[model samples]
Target: MKQEYEALFTPWKIGNLEIKNRIVLAPMGGTCIFGWMEPGGSHFDKEAARLLLKIAKHDCGLIIPGIAPVKDMLGGKWLYQNKRKFAELAEFMDELHATGAKMFVQMTAGFGRSFALTAPLAMLAKNKALNTLAKPYIDAEYLTAAPSVLPNRWADDVTTRAITEKEIKDIIYAFGETARLCKEAGVDGVEVHAVHEGYLLDQFTLKYTNKRTDDYGGSFENRYRFAAEIVKEIKDKCGDDFPVSLRYSVRSMTKAFQYGAMPGEDFEEIGRDMEESERAAKFLQDAGYDMLNCDNGTYDAWYWAHPPQYMPQNCNLEDVEHIKKFVDIPVVCAGKMEPDVGAKAVKEGGIDAMAVGRQFLADPKWVSKIKKGREEEIRPCICCHSACFNLTKHNGTANDQDLTESAGMCKCAVNPRSMQSKKYRVKPTDKPKRVAIIGGGVGGMEAARILALRGHEAEIYEKTSELGGVFIAAAAPEFKEKDKQLIAWQKHQLKKLGVKIHYNYEVKPDSLPSADEYIIATGAEANRIPIPGAADYAMDATDYLLGRKQVGKDVVIIGGGLTGCEIALDLFRKGKNPQIVEMKDDLIAVKNMCLANTSYLRDCFKTNKVPVYLNAGVAEITDKSVKVNLKDGRTVELPADDVIMSVGYHPIPLLQAAKNVHLLGDCKKVGNIRSAIWGAWDIAMKI
Candidate 1:
């Protein structure tokens, strides 16, 4: 093992509890042992529990499940009312302890105004008749309360009223009751979820969000009183010796209400600054919290809390380290944290531990790989947030994900068997058969791996020298280092599984390979616009990414979907001026797109002073200039040293009617990694 990672395995104390290692699995939505953000009765989620148990068996030291909402998001039943479920939790904890992992139940007051309200729920809140009719089952206003009457982070059409003083006390009581129940249920401790992420508790802490004259809102102490009181009540109920960690954001990192400060941007903070964080860290510690599970961000600065590939590694490390000085409690930082860099941070005593989230979703055996000196074998989290926290937004909708999908959050984009252990798992196939998968993209590789694991001969036919289809271009950007790592990991896995690889071999539709099954994964081609002189003047998006074409200083990229936006960002980073012309109202305004990734890209364009024309289209392409129709009614000619086409793609399934032939990845339909990978897994398991 690396000397730097030694600190990670060292024992650490949280109050009276002795944790065997400094590694922590930070909480994420839908992976909660006690049910995720589901809209129903609060109970033990066996699916989520099974996922955590697998992680525990992988040798994790401390595992914190996702938020156990103090007030149920669905039926408004207080969590304490579900006391019967605590018995199941006790038994689950017993099993976790056998693996030498201490579990912490993360209890939350609520999302309040920061809640990712879907369109249907927003409509329900707007209509008095509908709200009254749905009152027994759901209450939109109660679920979306605020510290003060404020504009909701999700919808501009709706405003959330201030949470009543009586309601605050009730929630505090709920916290104490929940903590007491957790201790009795054999849990090691409880972590408050949090005066962070600009949630209900956090709204009270931030001056901009809290404009109340009540005892719980004015001044620093009053603003903090709600959280402090919750801590005191929990300690009183669970015993003062019982450990309690606070999930804290060291700095809000917001430029203003509904705005975020870009990383390294020296903007005046409109939310909690570092100076206030230092004082608050001490105050929270003094109030009897044992440790600080820290990061940086608010709902406004979503990227910092839920970082994407665009954000740098260990983005919140400096701010967290600074906060550690003001308090004696152990501090852990989590924000796109790299294992090696985080281990270095731990070794230097900058932070006590590293709290990893999405990586655990990608690979449960991540820590075991590190401990066994097999760091290269660990699957990297690309931080796409496509399957995990994909709370999408676009024109005419606050959130695009359906309610059912919203409930089953935190599924991995790359790893299909994350929370879906019940559905997708490798149980040795009764009938082993030869499988030939065309194309070497992510989906093809995934299908090959699964088939190989199931005692089948799986062979991949790649036209290029290497695997990774369109994903090769996707991972080419400097910011996509992890995506590159993921590609390498996939290739390594395929080789280890003994899957046959025939490089530079493209199977033709006419001469199909002799196999039990054929999987078509020949990815889509970039759609070129049909403008005049486009063939001579405009370059394909994939060609530009593969470095086949070099554009001059000024580049205009057509299409503002995720691909085009990412390409534009790459172009800008490489000392080139890039302008984006999109037919959509916003960049990457499509479903299943995580807000964290999209917001970071959006912020980058604004921060770097890049030009983006939305709801616009290209009219014609010239040698050194291009004509465009703006969102309004104006048509203008803009200088374009080069034009990259990224409009969209069409499926290119080679043998759609062939017997026993399956279509996967882009060849079937142009979709993101999730659809491709999951689609491959779904078919592979059946065959």
Candidate 2:
């Protein structure tokens, strides 16, 4: 093990509890020991327990699973009512304790206005009578109720009503009961699901959300009264010796409703500032909290809490370190935290521990691998959030996520086996066959790797010299270092698996390789606009991203999708002026992409003053300008030194129908990495 990382391996104390190491598995949305968002009473989720137990065995010091609501979402039963689940957890904890790791059940009060409203739920909330009818099963009104009346985060039309004092008291009582139950279940401690992320409890704490004139609003103490009461209740019920951790956000980092402040941007905070956070930290500690599991951001500024690749490494360290001074209790920082940096902070008394969330979903053995000085073998999390916790929302949309993803939240995009152990696990096949994978992109490589793991002869044919196909171009941005790391990791895996690769060998349909089965992962070609002068003036998005072409001082990007928006941001960062023209109503207006990732790009564009023309289409391209037609039937010519086309892609498969031939990735359908890898897995498993 590296000497610099020794501090991370050292024991740490949170109240009377002593953790074996400084690595804390921060809670995610779906990996709760208790089921989340299901239409039934709370029960022990074996799948979630299996994943957590694996992490515990991997040398994680403290394990915190996803938020287990104090009240069940569907049945509206208090969590303490489900004593059988706690009994099951008690048995599970014996196995977990054998691994020398402590566990914490993070109990959430509720989402309130931050509840990610789906289209069907939004409909229920809009009609009072329908909501009343649905209250017995799935109460949309109660679920969306906030500290005060506020607009729902995902749905624009739905307004959350202010929660009553009676409901607040009920929830506080529930927290105490739940914490007591967790302690009885052999759980080491409990972390409050937060006075962070602008959830119900956070809504009560923030002045922007809590407008009540009564005991729970206005003044700082009043605003935080609900949170203070929760810890006090838990301490009173479970005894003061039982540690209680608070999920604390050092600053809100929000500017307005549905708007977030970008990193390094100068803006007036509309949510919690440092001054109040300093005072609140001390107050909450004094109130009975044992530790602070800290980060920054609300649901509005979600990128700060659930950071994408665009966010810097150790994004929340400085703020978390500063907050540590205000409270004597241990502080743990999350949000894109790097291990070495976290280790240094732990050694310097900057922070007590480092909390990591999504990376565990990407690679459960990362800690063990790091401890063995095999960091390169660890799979990297690209922070795409495509498969995991991608509750997407855009203009004129609700949550907009697929129902399956909404229910199963913590599945990793890169590593399929994170939450899904049974379905995606590698098993040796008795009947081995030679598999030829066409194209050396992510999908092809993944297919080859899986086949080789299944005791089959697997080989990849690449047209280009490199393995990463369009993803190489996609990951070329400076901010996409993790993506680059992923590519390296994949290459290393392929080499280690002994998968054969033929570079600069493009396979035509007529000139196919001699294999029992053929997997086509030829990828996609960029769609070019048919406008006049486009061929001469406009370059493909890949051209710019791959550094094959350069853009001048002023640039116009056609298509306001994720690729186009990211390019615009990249150009803006390079001190080049970039404008966007889109036919859609909003940028990245697609389902299954995380708001945390998209919102950062959207907010960055808005903050940097990058011109974005929505509901607009390109009419023609010129050498120095591009003519665009607006939604109002008006044509305008914008000055442009260069034109970049990022409209979309179309699959160009080698063969559509052939015996023993299967198509995956962009060759089958033009989609993101999630589709490509999962598609590869589906086909590879069958073969």
Candidate 3:
């Protein structure tokens, strides 16, 4: 192991329990061992269990599987009532213990107003009779009940009614009963999922969300009584030695409803502040919580908790370190934590452990790689919540995500076999054959790698000298360092796998190479909109990103999609003034994009004073200015030294159809990295 990471390998203790190392597998949403959002009664989710066990076997010290709701979403049965699942878990625990890893089941009180409401769920919430009929199957009302009546995070029409005191008491009792079952099942401990992330229990703690005069809300102690009582109940049911970790938010970086404060932005916090967090940290610790697994932000400021690439490394470290001073119990910092930074923090006693979540989904063997001093071989998580946890919401859409993705969270965009082992496994082919993959983008490279792994001779043919295709331009920004790393990782994997590459050789459909099968990954071309003088005055998004075109101080971006907004932010950071014009009502109003990723860019633009023109279209581009048509039917000329068009892309395949020929990636359908990689895997496995 490297010298810097030595501290991370050292032993750490959470209460009386000793963990072999300081790396903790943080809980995500859908990796729950007891199942999540399913229609039937709670049962042991073997898929999730298999994923967690793999991580444990790979040398993770402490494994905390995703949030297991104390009450089942369907049928609303208490978790303790599912005794069969506990028995299964007990047997699984014995197997996990053989790997020398401790296990903690994260139990959630529920998602109160923070419940991500879908369109159907919003309808069920608004119509009383519909909700009554759906109660047995979904219980949308019970799922969304909060400390006080508040608008749902994802839906404007859906309101979460104030939860009754009886429900609160029932939930507290459920925590005790569940903890007891976990203890009897031979589980090491249980982590409350939490008085954090603006969930049901967290709603009771925040003054803005909790307006009740009942015993659960009012003074600081009253506001925190819900959390304090949970730990106390767990201690009473299980022994005091049974370690309980609290998934804590050191500070809530929220500004208003559905708005978040950008990192380092000056704003008055509407959620929990630092002063209250310090006191609450000590209070919750004194109330029998053995450890504090800490981060920041609520559902309103979701980016701080579920940070994307734009967030700085160790984004939650400073606050977590500060909170550690207030509590004697062990502290684990999560949220984009770098391994080296975490090691330094652990060595200096800044934090006891480093909690990592999404990275494990990207590479389950990351810990083993680190210990073996082969960190470069480990795949890096680019933090694109494209496939995993992409519960999207915008100005007018409610949870605009595919229902399949909503149910199956924690699947990595880069690694297909993380949560989906059965679907995307590497098996030896019965017959090995030479395969040719056109284009050297991520999709083509992934196909070649998988084909080679399955005992096939695969080669890539690229038109350019480099391998990453348009992704090279996409990773040009400083904030997108992880994207660049991904490109490098793919190149390295292809080289190590001995996949032959023919660069600077573009193959025409008539001049195809001799191969048993062919994969067409020619990618897409940028859409050029017809506008007066645009052909002469405007450049494509890739031109600016690739440094082929330069923009002056006053720049106008023709689209407010993810690419345009990112370009605007990149320009602004580089000391250039950039303005955005979009026909949509909101920026990045696309489906399958996580709110955490989009909210960060939106908040950054707002904080940096980047001018945005929404519901507007660019009519024409002049040499020094661009004419825009506003939503109010007014034409305005904006000062623009240069114009960059980011209207989107269209696939341009070299070969449409042929026997033994398949298309993948943007050439087949223009989607994100998840689609490209998964599509490649599906085709590669078949071949």
* After superposition, candidate 1 runs with Cα above 4 Å error: 36-39, 657-659
lDDT against the true structure, per candidate, is 0.88, 0.92, 0.92
> What clash count goes with each model?
0, 0, 0
TM-scores for the candidates: 0.98, 0.99, 0.99
Worst lDDT 10-window in candidate 2: 35-44
Candidate 2, which segments miss by more than 4 Å at Cα?
A: 657-659
Q: Is candidate 1 or candidate 3 better by lDDT?
A: 3
Cα RMSD, each candidate: 1.2, 0.9, 0.9
The alpha-carbon root-mean-square deviation between model 2 and the true structure, to one decimal in Å, is 0.9
Clashing pairs in 2: none
lDDT string, candidate 3, 1-687, tens digits = 999999999998888899999999999988989886666957899999999999999999999999989999878889999899999999999999999999999999999999998899989988889999988788888899999999899998888899998988899999999999999999999999888888888898998899989898889999999999999999999989999999999999999988888888889998899999999999999899999999999998999999998899999999999999998999999999999999999999999999999999999999999999997798889999997799998789899998888888999999999889999998899999899999999999999999999999999999999998888888899999989999989999998999999999989878999999999999999998999989999999999999998889999999999899889989988999999999999999988899999988888888778999999988889999999999999999999999999999999888884778899999988998998899989999999
Tens-digit per-residue lDDT, 1-687, candidate 1: 777678788898998799999889999988888774665767899988988998999978999999999877777888888878999999998999999999999999988788888888888777779988998888888888889988878776878978899999999999999999999999999999997888888889999999999898889999999999999999899898999999999899898656788888989887899999989999999998999999989988999999988888899999999988888889989988877888888888899999999999999999998889998899888898888888987656787776667888889988988889889988789999998899999999999998998898999999899899989998988999998998899889998988999999978878877889999999888775678879989988888998998889999988888889999989888899999988878898888788777887887898788999988888889999888898678998878999999888988887883678899988888998889889988988988
Better of 2 and 3 by lDDT: 2
Model 2, 156-190: lDDT tens digits are 99999999999999999999999998898899999
Report how far residue 31 has shifted in candidate 2, in Å: 0.6
The lDDT, on a scale of 0 to 1, for candidate 1 is: 0.88
